[model samples]
Target: MKAAGILTLIGCLVTGAESKIYTRCKLAKIFSRAGLDNYWGFSLGNWICMAYYESGYNTTAQRVLDDGSIDYGIFQINSFTWCRHGKLQENNHCHVACSALITDDLTDAIICARKIVKETQGMNYWQGWKKHCEGRDLSDWKKGCEVS
Candidate 1:
């Protein structure tokens, strides 16, 4: 019984390290510091909305596509074009592993997302942005946040 209890505690600890869901204001502050607040004319609200739709602000979100490609992290960056997954050949413009994006630390994810935005049609690379964040009044995304 003692050993079983230890194992359960270890499992809980491991699961706790896997993912984190961030609040909107917390994300806004982080994104602002990263210069994503108005980068490429997209407001902070756009990014907030995108993150919500993509992974619900969860850092450990990952999805395997029908094409065998996988998307990782809050932004759901694709392995096929952005990051390398296992033995697959990838462009890897961000030069980071797909696994790196899934951590609670979002530094790698934000860096990779910036690269994707610069290379592609801005935030259009993310379908979530187009479907949810595009051309809408996004002032409410950062409404009460003191991000400066």
Candidate 2:
């Protein structure tokens, strides 16, 4: 049993680099405190729904886009534009490294996401928002999550 536990720990260290997948309510509470609720006319539900569809609340999620740009973190922020990945020239409008977006600390991610919304003037920057959340009743996203 001790050997098994050690192997599991080794496996996690080898395969997962600081990954944290948050439950909806827990993330909702965190986001609420981040002032995501009703931010720029987007309700907390919209933010919750976006987090779900973007990365399933995974803090270290990553996806490579068709154009070879990468999306990182719960927001799946693009590397080509919003952040610097240290590989190529990036717009880096948010002045954050893409690596910063994938850590357990969400401060960088949330700040960058807000900048994206502010620059785009809405949630249209995220396809997830356009498809799964737009014009939809997203009230249940934060329903049972008592966020004060």
Candidate 3:
């Protein structure tokens, strides 16, 4: 029984590690429905471009930073200021577990992202956006994705 339980837990962990990488159009629709299409004066294309640069649209993507803080999920929300991982001190403005960001469901990520935008310098909070999506014609990001 113990071995069975251990195997089950391992299976679950392995499954969790696998991320869902959304297609650009698919993500555009999702973000549009979530009101992120033009939120904070940025287009849905900007969000899509940012997600690609941040996590390649992989929900389970996580990167441990040089400062020991982890960026989680497709948007790569950070542990240092946005989320709490384990017992680490965090600002936790998102009011969610860092683990929550890495799930297939992006509801929490979208909600937290909204909070970050409202509190900080809008989409500029994501360096990915500034580097790739800003000051560029991002129409190709959602070119054929009719997000109605």
Candidate 4:
């Protein structure tokens, strides 16, 4: 293998180390501090539940959709219309690179998520919420987290 290939391999390893799988309770605290609680009539449970269904709490999660776009981070933010993958940033409503969504630091991810939800006018933008979280008693998501 060439030096570039080796460097790429090392980069992957480092990136993997940079990721994290946060506990539910911890996530509740984080989300609360980040102002996700009832931000748009959606409780903290909604946020926590969506994060679980989207990426199982993993920070480095990435999913490639059928349309050649990808979903990134714990929120599974879509690259097609939300974030940019390469140099093309025209359609990136989140104003962030797709890679920013995968980082353990969720500042950008949270901000972008707000934009996505606001633009769509609701939490219906996330299939996870519609499938597993919506119309359900999501109180357990923040149970004992003391985020309230």
Question: In model 1, how large is the Cα lDDT of residue 113?
Answer: 92
Off by over 4 Å in 2: 1-16
Number of the top lDDT candidate: 2
In terms of TM-score, the best-performing candidate is: 2
Question: What's the TM-score of each model vs. the native?
Answer: 0.87, 0.88, 0.87, 0.87
- State the lDDT of candidate 3 residue by residue for 1-148, as single tens digits: 9999998678558546666889888999899999997898888888899999999998988887999999999999999899878898898988899989999899999999988888999989899999988899988998888974
Candidate 2 local lDDT, residue 141: 95
Instruction: Identify the runs in model 3 with alpha carbons over 4 angstroms from their true place.
Output: 1-15
The per-residue C-alpha lDDT of model 3 at residue 81 equals: 92
Q: Write the per-residue lDDT of candidate 4 for residues 1-148, one digit (tens) a residue.
A: 6999998788668555476899999999999999999988899999999999999999888787788888989999988898888875448988898889898899999999888888896889889889999999999999998878
- Estimate, for each residue in 120-141, the C-alpha lDDT of model 1 and write its tens digit: 8999999989998999999999
**C-alpha lDDT of residue 60 in model 1:** 77
lDDT of 2: 0.91
User: For every candidate structure, what is the RMSD over all alpha carbons to the true structure, in angstroms?
Assistant: 4.6, 4.5, 5.2, 4.1
